[model samples]
Target: MKAVMIREFGDPRGLAVVDLPVPVPAPGEALITTEAVGVAGADVLIRSGALAAYGFREGHIPGGEIAGTVTAVGDGVDPAWVGQRVWAFTGTGGGYAEQAVAPIGEVLSLPAGLSAVDAVTLGSSGVVAHFGLAHAHFSPGETVLVRGAAGSIGIMAVQLAISGGASAVAVTTSSTERGRRLRSLGATHVLDRSGAGGPDDPTGYDVIIDVVAGPDMPAFLDRLNPNGRLVAVGAVGGQPPADFGTRLMAAFQKSMSFATFSAATVTAAAQQAVRTEQFAAVDRGELHTVVHEVLPLEQAVVAHQKMDGGEVFGRIVLLNSPFH
Candidate 1:
């Protein structure tokens, strides 16, 4: 089998393609013949050594979600899964290869009409958005603000907020073109990323789904309406200032709250259910899946470059050849 590994950190060019023995599924796991791998911000973070504190290291295979066909299953797994098209979560690694193994519980059958590329794009991101919204205790008719609303997770947050009956879906994006695309996806207000929030309407957003958290994150706290909730799901911009919480404290009278969310907090069963629901929604046309481009597995370095360049509007999927 062929795999992409990090020869060094801090540069996308550090990603190198090499050959390796195919891995066999362990107990309660299944081996997937890789078809499509989602190139995500986490992959970029890992390759750039930004996630070193989280245990990512050189020689790591940086992929989390993949869509493919099941070629084999381990003990305690259903044989019927073999030959079935599915999407699997590879935890935080092992997906930058021609083949990967995932626990049977993390594998899901592809919904009818959902392509491998689309599945991988929407799989883990959709689950995170779904659960992140829930973590904020989002309610129908409440206004929502999705910060950094350009990537797959941010895009999913915008659309899901609208479908969940948000009174208005506002987003913070980097460019006019990106903002335009988000508006077409049902965003009611498009604000500049630096602006941090919408116009000063005393009644601000009832919920804020933030992906970018840095020194600027404190600015959004004031944008939340009284009793509003802000959930930080990603920190691509790095951690906020140590005193960032002072804003929430200063606004204590408003009863506003701030917290962070990770899909790991949710159980595997819940995550799988949300992924399944999201896939079905995309297949049924109630949801949208955005894929920027598809590259061959060997071009893993190129994929990381696109991610680090910060211009990709959505996921860049890596495709694997069946012959490999």
Candidate 2:
């Protein structure tokens, strides 16, 4: 099996393709013949060493999610899973290879019409978005905002917000073309990445799915409707400072709540259900996955470079072979 390894941190060029023995599944796990691997922002952060505090060591593989077919299952697993097409979380590492191992619980079968590429892109991101919104306590006809709205998670958040009956969906992004693309994705208003935020209307917003949090987050706090909640799901912009709460104190009167969501903590059954719902929605034409491009697995370095360049509109995935 071939995998991309990070020989060093701080540079995408440090990612190198290397060969290794294929891994066998342990108890309660399955071995997947890699078909598509998701290249995500967190994977880039892992490669850059920014997330070193997360317990991962050097020389670790960088992919987090993969979609493929089960070739074998370990003890206590159902043999029927063998030959079933599925999408899985490869835990803290191991998804960048031609073959990867995952716990059976993390693997979900793909529906008839969902291709591996679409499944990996939608399955990985959709589950995260669904979990965030589920816990954020959003309601019908309310206003919502999604930061970094042109990215994979952002796109899903926007469409899901609309479908959930939000009266309006606002987005934040740096590119004009990408903002236009986001609008087409159902964002009612698109705000510049650095701006006063969508006017201080009292209607405000009931929920916010923020993936990009930084110094300007306090501004969004004022944009939230009273009793509204802001769910911090990603820090692509940068992590909030240690005095984050002090900066946003002015919004305390609104009884606003700031919560951080990590899909890792969600139950496997819940995550699998979300993935299945998203695939079904895509099949029914009620949802869509924006794929920026499909690159070969060996081009992981180039993919990281593009992610850092900051113009990508949606998910950029890697594949081990050409498949339908």
C-alpha lDDT of all candidate models, in order: 0.90, 0.86
lDDT of 2 by residue, 1-324 (tens): 788999889889999988889999999999999999988988988998998898766789988799999999999999999999999998888999999999999999888888888987888789878888887998888888898888899999999999899888888888778878998989888778853344642347789899988777877776778888999989987887777776357766779888999997888898888788889999888899999989999999999999999888889999996321
Error of 1 at 112 (Å): 2.8
Model 2 scores a C-alpha lDDT of 0.86
- Model 1 per-residue lDDT at 81: 99
Q: Model 2 misses residue 173 by how many Å?
A: 1.1
Highest TM-score scorer: 1
Q: Poorest 10 consecutive residues of model 1 by lDDT?
A: 194-203
Which stretches of candidate 1 lie above 4 Å from their native place?
196-203, 322-324
Quantify how close model 1 is to the true structure by its C-alpha RMSD in Å.
Answer: 1.7
Question: Using Cα atoms with residue i matched to residue i, what is each candidate's TM-score against the true structure?
Answer: 0.96, 0.95
Best by lDDT: 1
